[model samples]
Target: MRQTIESRQAELNAARLRMLNKKQEAGDRRQEAGDRRREAGGRGRWTEIA
Candidate 1:
């Protein structure tokens, strides 16, 4: 029983790491896109109007 619980915990940790990596990758892509937009011009649909 203890071994089963430990294995389950390991699986959960591995899944959590995978999710975290995916989020990081998405964030990096977003940042890169934002940089490209800024380089092209200061015009983006999501730009806030102040």
Candidate 2:
């Protein structure tokens, strides 16, 4: 029973780690897009007044 619980906990931890990594990747993509837009021009394409 103890071993089973430990294995389940390990699986849960792995899943959490994967979720965190995915979140970080999404944030990185957003930052890269912002950098590209900034490089092209200061005004935001999405916003009308910026």
Candidate 3:
């Protein structure tokens, strides 16, 4: 009975780790997209001035 409980707890912990990893990945993607937008905007301003 105790072993079963331990196994279940381990599974839950693994799932929680996976969820955290996914959240981190999503945040990194959002940051990358923002960087791309900023780069594009900077280029547009340069083109207009030239």
Candidate 4:
């Protein structure tokens, strides 16, 4: 019973790490896309209102 609990805990920890990694990757993509958009249009173009 103790071993089963430990294995379950390990699996939970692994899942949490995977989720965190995916979240970080998404944030990086968002930042990179934002950077590209700004570069494509001039500086401050991202914040300008139509």
Say which candidate scores most in lDDT.
Answer: 1
Q: So what's the TM-score on candidate 1?
A: 0.81
Q: What are the root-mean-square deviations of the candidates from the true structure over C-alphas?
A: 2.6, 2.8, 6.6, 3.5
**Model 1: residue 7 alpha-carbon error in angstroms:** 0.4
Residue by residue across 23-46, what tens digits does model 3's lDDT show? 999999977776776778856544
Give the candidate order by descending TM-score. 2, 1, 4, 3
What TM-scores do the predictions have? 0.81, 0.84, 0.76, 0.77
Write down the lDDT of every candidate, Cα atoms only.
0.85, 0.83, 0.82, 0.84
Scored by lDDT, model 4 comes in at 0.84
Q: What is the per-residue lDDT of model 1 for residues 1-50, given as tens digits with 9 covering 90 to 100? A: 99999999999999999999999999999888777767777766846323
Candidate 4: stretches off by over 4 Å? 42-50
Total clashing residue pairs per candidate?
Answer: 0, 0, 0, 0
Worst 10 residues of 2 by lDDT: 41-50
Screening candidate 4 with a backbone cut-off below 3 angstroms (N, C-alpha, C), the clashing residue pairs are none
Model 1 per-residue lDDT at 9:
100
**Residues 1-50 of candidate 4: C-alpha lDDT, one tens digit per residue:** 99999999999999999999999999999888877776777456475433
- Pairing residues by index, what is the TM-score of model 2? 0.84
Q: Comparing candidate 2 with candidate 4, which one achieves the higher lDDT?
A: 4
